[model samples]
Target chain A: MINNEVTKLLNMTYPVIQAPMAGGVTTSELVAAVADNGGLGMMGAGYMTSSQIREQIREIQQLTEGPFGINLFVPNEFHVSEQEVELASNRLQPIREQLDLQQKEQVDIPNFDKVSESFQQQIEVVIEEKIPFCSFTFGIPSKEIIEELKQHHIILIGTATTVKEAVENEKAGMDMVVVQGCEAGGHRGNFLSGDQESLIGLMALIPQVVDNVSIPVIAAGGIMDGRGLMAALCLGAQCVQMGTAFLNCEESGAHASHKEAILHAAEDETVLTRSFSGKWARGLKNDYINEMHEDESLFPAFPVQNKLSQDIRKAAAAQNKTAFMSLWSGQSPRLAKKQCVESLMEHIISETRKIGRKV
Target chain B: MINNEVTKLLNMTYPVIQAPMAGGVTTSELVAAVADNGGLGMMGAGYMTSSQIREQIREIQQLTEGPFGINLFVPNEFHVSEQEVELASNRLQPIREQLDLQQKEQVDIPNFDKVSESFQQQIEVVIEEKIPFCSFTFGIPSKEIIEELKQHHIILIGTATTVKEAVENEKAGMDMVVVQGCEAGGHRGNFLSGDQESLIGLMALIPQVVDNVSIPVIAAGGIMDGRGLMAALCLGAQCVQMGTAFLNCEESGAHASHKEAILHAAEDETVLTRSFSGKWARGLKNDYINEMHEDESLFPAFPVQNKLSQDIRKAAAAQNKTAFMSLWSGQSPRLAKKQCVESLMEHIISETRKIGRKV
Candidate 1:
């Protein structure tokens, strides 16, 4: 059951793929550990600079000789007004005071031209480093970039939150697509559909996507253990991409407090908020999310809002105050466990076999 | 895989339960067809009076000798101020005018005591009719009622939207619990968690609920075919209760426009709205939903708001105008087929066997 088109294409023993969660969650050690354990491990290059991406690829190559992947964020054109930024800054004033941090003026808002240029450089690095696999989030890359990647024999994967998005990815020549369900953590990958419409559950998402596209479908979201893996496969997905399950692993770069918050969180404790970043992401409910519930829509978009909250998140982490930090988690946090990659992979495989036999 | 504890308990050969959809969708012919085809059929007796329930039970008995179930809405104490009802009526005036419905002199608002009395009478009818299986939505019944039903050898089921609600049902002596996911159509059965918190997807809701409770879990939400059944089973559900799948059946009493809307809908076309009944329900986005979006939160609770919009919906249905009627559907409308219950059952069973043999 574990051996199929996905395994053959990715050249892995198991059909598990570690989700590339940005903001320092996917460490090279974590990626390498999963690769060594017969699963595809992906480095989250969405927020990394070209230099950082190159260095991590080298570091992972030394840790494991197995094939690994990298994921990049396709930059979307966004508008940010100065007055809106000021209003957002004023709203964060109380949180800064609570963190006892000095108020800094002139936050560096990201420029779209610079972001797009950086993405190009990141793609070049993937080709230069000869990474076996590369996945994209937010949107699909241009025809030229995809052709360039394919020229270098890099298998490209696209992230989608709807069947139309999946069809678009297939038309754009993606080798596979990860269908992110509403139960997923981190950022939502809805490009064509609105936030509310893109929230199709895995139970409905996988089959619909598979029926529309010829490429192998990878299901991502609140999948934690064997039950999720088997269910995804039964729903027509060829593989499963997990984020929260791997984020709690020992080798992950996630903060201790962030890990603990998920470890103790209930299924209903997580809520989707664009407060941390302009794009809606699922995370544990805290004081910051509650405070920004009303004003989240008024804040700047994506990289801009993410940059504005950097200092507060850093300070909160330094002080170990989880309330001010983004504690990202999927809906199935109650099933999360703090373990190593090898053990998690072993458990998923064994339990999947057990269920397959029993059913 | 089809034969399990749930099937044994329900005295059915297949692990399929036709969702007890209210509002005349679950006709006697439809229920009898499902029962005769190896699945457990259920009557949506939530809105039926004592005499209506008795008549339906007798009607279904004449159609099929197989066992079937009935679902009741547990009455909750509600307060309806005259001002609020008037305000709600004023808000709905434009829709009523659009539908050309005449304004009545006095709107008969439901009272809590009378609703409770009606529920008691309904329960007495179920007992007298010797219904083999009974289920409750919104909340659990009283302990004395459970004891009385058990003494009569009737199997009890409870609907839940979260893990805590499932545990409560088990504690209340429910023989089984149906975990309704966010992808489910119709009214949400969230008694303990808020609307937002209770919207856990089936991918996250099923396994978490299964891990917490000892009773059998029947997965519900966006399930339309054999793939959904196998996926739900893999997620630890002993059976699956489907609504939208059965709502479009040939024998179902749904309006022709309702069936056509679902048959032609896309996966992302449905959305959750409270304008129809003052309770959150997933359905196709139409004129009524779009117009009432801004004022849905201000509408009176359940039966009160449900009463306020009755005339408009009835007129729309009579005229075959889907824009004003509630075309309830799940996320996977693309998978729905306008077939008879017997053909649908045979397709599901064959697909399940094929998937089982392949996997």
Candidate 2:
């Protein structure tokens, strides 16, 4: 069996990682379960506050005394004009009122002005808790912070949507990099260019990155089973990081209907739409995307648009209506299976071992 | 060395086939060159009349006694209301005048009503000429036509953009099916479902098709060179049909500027746009797609819009301007090379063999 290089770095038996899915998807239970199964489990700490991150870390430690990682989003400081945000908010008001979603109290969208303060606090917690693994997405982290993390013996990983980002990550001394393909779900981790321009699929991404950089490479996007694992290895990946595969797992934090939507998604049904969030994310087509897609100029840049749609998405999920929910999934969600994390891990490992020898 | 199944079936040395590209790209020289190199070459006859097909067949026969295939576009009959056609015409008036392309005499757009007559004439030419191999795309051909070709000892292949379409091809008695992933360039092979819903990528397509159908599967889309050839083999495809890789070949009929565009296209530059043609096609982003994309409602269905934009496309190509041309490409244009067809074929075969042994 090929004991991939990333497994040694992540302190895992199998070269498989449960992709950290932000926006209320990955939970402490899910992370603990994945780690307990002898794979790298990660907390999606990008959307969490310092307190929430601390609580989740302790809860994960309580459930499983195994190594795990936390994923954070690098700061992308950009502002949507007040006129644009106001226009976007006004346009979404009809959808919000029609769904009667305003009644529910909402969590504040993270303010970009205070983003650095919160991010610093979160990084401090990772150091204080002696977190062993940490990954960042969206953009390259500052060199000083990376060195600080390295001093604490933290194995740093970076998410890249393009080869340039991967090279930058390597220059920043990341131990590894997750190459997120265009087929990946959620917001793209593009920094050097427009996320749309960085749509390099994993099949083309892995080998090129391997050829250019010395660091271990992790493949992500549309990887759902052992076949995907074997293919990624064939493409020269050190490991495979899968998010869509675990979306339906029993320990996953996905709402029942969100999980159902993922289970029922067809291979080609999910599309990159900015209607749900200001940033491009792959999700199953819903009325929200269709209705607001006519005039994309009406939507503000991400975070603002992501924030405005949050309440409607929450309401859609609460009522089990997919009409407005951001059913984030990879391109091949049809391959998803509902099982426990352990069972999913077992099948992937066995299948890879079975097929890995033949190739 | 792995002797791929399609190679044995087609009496070729390598499991590579030149994808038949219509619209003035694939030439008799390219086809003969590929066949001469021990790879299967295909004549794209979907855009040619019976006499043109006969002349090209004779030209190919003279150049290489080795077998080559002819690809036809299955007649998809649908009436476009005159109003829709007029709206499409009106929308292009501004683009047409801006490019000063009105000097060229326009060929009458094929009347959908007379489609069967022309298709019948083409098939009759195929039969009378005793063509050895034939393939169909766009939709399923009639049983009588397939039976007729089979009686002539012609090996038949059908194009499918999804597994369901692949199964349908098998049921219709095609010898094999080309499983086209969304990553493929040119016009999509979608018929059963809307092309948008048929955007399944190659990584997810090849394995599922191989599992579901007993017939040999020829994988297409995003396959650039020998590494792609090896990957398709690992995915259980019997062979690969690559179009983008050959777009820049010296023997190809693509304009020099088109070749340059394909060579320079970024990973995410190509997108599915119906602006050029009524049907969704992947190509480099140009002004035609960008300006016309906003009011796609003003466009008519395939062949019509495909025909309407011909003058503008021709003008743009003549001027060496990318703003109005359809630089058809896939997601991996960065891997394309500008070489003679013979050199490209040699490189691909050698690379596949080298990588195939290692994998």
> For residues A66-150, what per-residue lDDT tens digits would candidate 1 score against the true structure?
9799999999999889888888888888999999998856887888999999999999999999988999999999999999999
Give the local distance difference test score of model 1: 0.93
lDDT of 1 by residue, B1-359 (tens): 67999999999999999999998999999999999999999999999999999999999999999989999999877898999999989999898888888774587899999998999998898899899899999999988889999999999999999999999999999999999999998889999999999999999999999999999999999999999999999889999999999999999999998999999999999999989888899999999999999989999898888988888899999989999999999899999998999999999999898778767
**Which 10-residue window in model 1 chain A sums to the lowest lDDT?**
A102-111
- Candidate 2: stretches off by over 4 Å: A80-109, A167-173, A207-214, A287-300, A315-318, A322-324, B80-106, B287-297, B315-324, B353-358
List all candidate RMSDs to the true structure.
0.8, 3.2
- Looking at model 1, the pairs that clash are none
